[model samples]
Target: MWILISFWVIALAAVIATIKYRKPLLLTVPFFAMLGFLVVQIAMVPMPFWETVRFVFSLR
Candidate 1:
């Protein structure tokens, strides 16, 4: 739940940052790229709580 919420929050932040900074593609692209890397890193680590909850409640 928290992870999902945080993901959306980060996405929203990226969008807002892009708009405010007037660098829509430039800002958002790298933000999402780094976010993807962070998610992969998290998956590689041993996070029982988040991993289990994420899998159990996965929407995709």
Candidate 2:
């Protein structure tokens, strides 16, 4: 199962760090983009998990 609890924790930490350090907002944008990409890749909700489905049906 795709898990996001840890991601949320890390994101929260990043927010805290940004507040403390005053980093540029652009920095967080990339971080969130990457996170979204990984979440989609792991969850396989948009696609199958590398299970190679055949397009054509064959006679048994």
Candidate 3:
């Protein structure tokens, strides 16, 4: 949950910085964001795949 919050916070900050500086953060930021998500994925290594799938479905 903290990771999710941090993701949004970082994204918001990145967008603001990009707009203020007139840089190409639109292209570069997503790669880094996806890398952050990949790290979160790696951290969930012990959870069973089926459990994760079921939990995803339960959210709906």
RMSD of candidate 2 to the truth, in angstroms, is 8.7
TM for every model, in the order presented, reads: 0.45, 0.41, 0.52
Over 4 Å off, model 1? 26-60
Candidate 3 or 2, higher lDDT: 3
Candidate 3: minimum summed lDDT over ten consecutive residues — where? Answer: 22-31
Candidate 1, 1-60: lDDT as tens digits: 876777677777778887888876745665676668677766776667597558746957
lDDT of 3 by residue, 1-60 (tens): 897788788778778888888886564785698787875775586877677756656895
Model 3 residue 39 distance off true place after TM-score fit, in angstroms: 3.8
Estimate the TM-score for candidate 1.
0.45
lDDT of each: 0.70, 0.59, 0.74
TM for candidate 3 is 0.52
**What value of lDDT does candidate 1 attain over all alpha carbons?**
0.70
For model 3, the superposed segments whose C-alpha errors exceed 4 Å read 40-60
lDDT of 1 at 39: 71
